[model samples]
Target: MPAGTFTMGDSSGDKNRADGETPRHEVAISAFEIDATTVTNDAFARFVEETGYVTEAESFGFSAVFHLALAAPEADVMGPASGTPWWAGVKGADWRHPGGRDSDLDGRGDHPVVHVSWNDAVAYCEWAGRRLPTEAEWEYAARGGIDGAKYPWGDQEVDEGGWRANIFQGEFPRHNTCEDGFLTTAPVRSFAPNGYGLWQMVGNVWEWCEDWFHPSTYRRGTTAEKRTLVTDPAGPESGQSRVMRGGSYLCHLSYCNRYRNSARSQNTPDSSMGNGGFRTVALRVESQA
Candidate 1:
């Protein structure tokens, strides 16, 4: 948790579909530390090599494959295979083989690793002598001191000055010219950092946080709700899905603009997909309380 103060949530724009990003407010956070970027295959390889740890994706023997990245023996490839036809359950798609046994992370050592679950992320954090950030901490870091700003850089559009982060730049799931220089996952250092020196915090991958999912808590009987103004406020005690942040490259205005800083989404602990992955954060071994 790097020390900083800024408004969280959407402060200036109505340019979003996510209702949870409304009522941007000021928030003060303590000084802690976080990952400079999302974890990569190389990084995770180090953990696994040293600890012999196996990820859930590895143990389960399957990872979700995007419809476009799947091989159809004669079928309609539309969206992600997890919930859509485009996604196909591929076997042996762990860190070693991101696309099952056929694909590999050859030149993708620097790319943000995908196919991880909430459980996998937690295990990595523990092995690295760190802990995942609470939802509040994750949001604070993602804000990058922009406060109520719509993005880590600002309210400026992605094309006004060209895309600053890695996100879908073309039409929906149909065509992606890699206009932003990357089609799937850009090089981890492909973009600039936010106000707090955090890179790729807004896009690249949706990171898992140490919190549960809860939508009703954000609603305040029309006045003001305390839970909405979360301050290191860990979400619900139990939930079917865990908290995830920092939208992924799959996000697009035509589909999901979850790439925004204020934007958030979630998935079950057991679920894994091309767009669903996580990054780990640390609070300093001494800050553990």
Candidate 2:
């Protein structure tokens, strides 16, 4: 995106206020190069093959998997996560075995690799000579230059003119109608690209951002006289959880209606789940010669 200023945060007026998407503010973003799609299993596989690196999930011998998508047998299943019964901690669940030990990336190499933690994504970035986009940059790119638009395509609903994203169509965590031709994750390029030519920016998987999450990050440093134009806001200086943007396939209107441009979520740097993944942004290296 070229250097430009745009209003950031919930313009819809219907977002979950607790998610820190409030206090709508203007932000000026610098031009940066971002990947058109989330990193695929194939891409990650190359990173692993070359570096011989093991992901956090692989090290832990388990990762969170949606109950409906669990392919592990009763022996490999470790029960549901606390509070979110829809997710089960399955042993042997990693990026390679997304569902479980029984699952493989046979024909799904092009799909976004899940069960990747923020630390894992940063490891991949280090190997790939790239970095995760900041929360501000991610939102700016997802907005596609459309100031304060709800969805990436515009303010139109996901199911309005057709399936604009790969989110739950039926009752979430129970039955997915697959109205969008996807029960789990669709290909990275399943939906139409946003105006910035970025694909699946708001669905398929939650992309990690390089920012510590805080509920009141937007409300800081504001006065009656002047509205600060936060240029390239990098989020809080310290927090336990990093920001995650672009809701995943598990997102539904009834529950996680966070598949919009301004929606936000967070998780610990080491947390990994079936619905989590990330894309990288190229680092601008200044010429030394």
Candidate 3:
């Protein structure tokens, strides 16, 4: 991991930019090692098998799954999330079985693990002796060394030539063209890595970060008199939800454009969904001078 300063929020007054993304500010981050790819099914399965740990979804008896991915009983019983009916709360939708009781990892060993909550991510990080990247660290890493770029690879064309990260192509929620060759989560490293050799940083799944969500966290830094150089911001002291970055396969211009490097979203720490997953980071130990 390389430590440096970078602009941290949306500088473009893009109409697609969300309100929480405004007041673009500068952030300096210390060196830290982060996983090149989001946690995969095989890695997560190993953690589960070794620790015999049960994810919150398993204990809660249900979790959010994409409505299109579920059918029959699972879909029938668990109503969709308010407004965003694309997300259905399905019984037995744990990290191991993303769709429901009937679903399994199958051949998706390399795919980024889904149906994981912030708490679940923290647990995995703890077991692995790592920690979730802070919201600032996440955005910096996602930028992949290119400052103020719209996307990780520095192109907003999205599906220009059927390349780039995995995201909704056709019509979001209603349809997915799968132009990127994936309707849902793609295998880790399925696409090109960024400038920092980080894979799937902008899409595929929303990675959990170590920060509480607040809409105006960057507003103060934007003041003309205040020093805009913030170092390792940890977000708000308290919030209803934890921060999530990188967007997901469900992202589309029709409804959501959060796949941008600066875009952010959040969910309850206990809420696990098919579009959510995470990677871990480790503090770089410095030798005494």
Candidate 4:
């Protein structure tokens, strides 16, 4: 059980971060139980086998594949790339086939599963008797026990003695030596948990939130419009993309540097691509007899 009050977001989190994380604000939340790490492949597989569940990607016949994931010879090809020409649609890019056709969970049973859509996550949560965290709840948990200091651990960047979350350890896009001992999503518990006992709050793969992304909904976060400020934002009433938090392994300091605890982004809940994934949160209820 992790319970604490934390400063939601602040400009001090990342000194050179995008405007989306600005105007750090104070947010308080009640204590709750959160999975220490993102749901794992094996865990998800069990859920499917038990309930005969099939994910959206599986039903749709394909999911989006990262450019680099297709570098292997045996890797299935993705084509008709649009927004990010590099992103290709792979027929087998579901949780079971993380890297499209060729790649497998392998020894990565503990690594957080990726390529999940919001609906998929919701289904899994329902099956587990859990639910997706509200946007406010997620922000509070990500901050861990830290209050408004910036970042899960504080304003400081990865220091010499301390290691941060599992984001891009090397240069962006090309040339990853896996300095963090992982080229992709590390084991769910690979790194230390934040003060709130939540893993991958700052990095790993982005987790889907129940909220739909609306620039007017969030007071902070990068947006050119004043209408973007949203309170207790549950995302847009109707929109193509839902909100996503906790940057992915694809995030890099040089390019998509939004791995910060408070930084937020979105994707079409119906669109299954990229390394988007999710985690489950629990609600504690007292029963009256």
Candidate 5:
């Protein structure tokens, strides 16, 4: 665990930033240990094997899989998500079958497990004696040692010399250049680690956090008179969706520019998708005392 203070949101001049990321503010984080990488298929498999736990996708009998991964026939039969047409609700698309019943982990044991929900992540964290990082903690950690940088690495171009993260390349939803040498989920350690030695903190998968989704969360925390210095803010008390940080491989600058450290998104607790996964964080026992 490493404790520190950091700026918590995007600046007004930051391009492609969403309204939710407004009112840039500073946050003080307490000491905590976050995973260097997301939980892999092997790790999640062990959890399921030992406890016989079933993922929400499995229980619901379907999940949102990327359209690019679906076969032409499957894609035709299963239309894309209403809001984001790039994703398709694939039947039997559980964690085991990432693209439906035909898909399997195969040689991707080291890849981050997908089609996981916030509830499933919570169960894994509980079983592992850890918890999800709050959105503030997640941002603080993802920023590494740098302040207000666009990525875990400095604000260099994504493919400066070569691919840094596993984000989408070329045209989105239609064609992928695969310049990063990946079409779907890359291995958990496919890229270099951030300053904190955290792998894939900004891409490959969208990590679930412990905060509730509220567009004006930061705005609500401030008054017209003055700004409040919120230490270790835990986000809203209640909401319909949970916070999801670190955009996935489906992310592209052409559309979703949420692969940045401070960028955020959300999903229902039970909504599982192929790009949704999570990492765990352990609070310092001494701090808890």
Candidate 6:
């Protein structure tokens, strides 16, 4: 995006204040180039082939999968994750086998590659000579230059005119109506692109950001003052978990309505799951004689 300044954080009154998406602030970002869509399985496969890199999930022998998307048999299923019974730690649930051992990329090569941890994303970035967008950069790009809008497409409810994003349509975690034509993940380019020509920025999967997450990150430092324009705020210097944005297919209005421009979430760097993925960005290098 071109170098510009915009207000960041939740402006909508209906924000999950606990997620620290509040205390709206002004942020100035420099010019940078970002992927139009999250990394697809086909793109990730090429990275794996080129580097022979094994993802964290592949090394861990298992990864988190939504219970409803589990394709593994009873033998491969490892039961639900603690506190979140909707997720199960299933064996062989890596990017290649998103559902479990029984699943494969197959015709879903164009879909965002899930089960990729923040660390895995970083590895891929290194191999590709790119980097994950900072939390601020991600949000700014996601906004698509719409300024203060709840979503990338200017605050019209996601399903208002039709299915704008691939999110839960029915009672979440129980019965997915698939009213949006997707139960888990739709193609990376399923929805209309934002004004910036970026697709699926608010749904399909949670994209990892290159920033440590802290509930009070915004309220802790100089960014706390709305008058101060935080220039390219990276995030907390140190934290246990990294930031994740854009929500995912499981997001629902009745349950997790985080499919907005300012919604935020986090996970350990090494944690991988079926609803997680990432995109990359590159700094603009001017030509020189």
- lDDT per residue as tens, model 5, 1-289: 4778888888325544453887778778888899999999999999999999988888987888887786333543367778889888887788998877888899999999999999999999999999999999999999998988888898886799778999999888799989999898999998799999999998899999999988888878452126766788998999999999989899898888888887879999999998989999884546553
Candidate 4 wrongly placed segments (more than 4 Å) = 1-5, 13-23, 71-75, 220-236, 287-289
Clashes of each: 7, 0, 0, 18, 0, 0
Single out the weakest 10-residue window by summed lDDT for candidate 3.
Answer: 10-19
Candidate 2 at 138: error in angstroms? 0.5
The superposed Cα distance between candidate 2 and the true structure at residue 255, in angstroms, equals 0.6
lDDT ranking, best first: 2, 6, 5, 3, 1, 4
Clashes in predicted model 6 = 0
Encode model 1's per-residue lDDT on 1-289: one tens digit a residue: 5565666665555435443655555555677778878888789889889999877878887777665555333332233454455467776666676655666788999887788888888888888888888777887887777667777788787666777888877777777777888767777778788887888887777888888876542443321455333345565788788878878777788777777776768788977776665666664535555
Q: lDDT by residue for model 3 over 198-286, one digit each (tens)?
A: 99998899999999988877775433248557788888889899999988988887877888888888899998988899999985546
Candidate 6: residue 260 lDDT (0-100): 92
lDDT of 4 at 279: 84
* Better-scoring candidate (lDDT), 1 or 6: 6
Output the worst ten-in-a-row residue range by lDDT, candidate 1.
Answer: 71-80
Off by over 4 Å in 6: 287-289
Candidate 5, residue 27: the lDDT equals 78
For candidate 6, the per-residue lDDT at 212 reads: 98
Q: What are the per-residue Cα lDDT tens digits for candidate 2 across 1-289?
A: 7778988889787688789897788888887889999999999999999999999999999999999899988999998888999999999999999999999999998999999999999999999999999999999999998897898899898988888999988877799999999989999988799999999999899999999999888888751136877788888899999999999999987889889999999999999999999999988634445
Instruction: For model 5, name the residue pairs that clash.
Output: none
Where in model 2 is the C-alpha error above 4 Å?
Answer: 222-225, 285-289
User: Per-residue CA lDDT of candidate 4, range 90-149, in tens?
Assistant: 877788887776778789788777777889899899999998887777877777666665
lDDT (Cα, tens digit) per residue for candidate 6, span 154-268: 9899989898998988887799989999889999888799999999999899999999998888786778855688898888889999999999999988888899999999999
Candidate with top TM-score is: 6
- TM-score head-to-head 1 vs 6, winner: 6
Quote model 5's TM-score.
0.94
Give the Cα error of residue 94 in candidate 3, in Å: 0.9
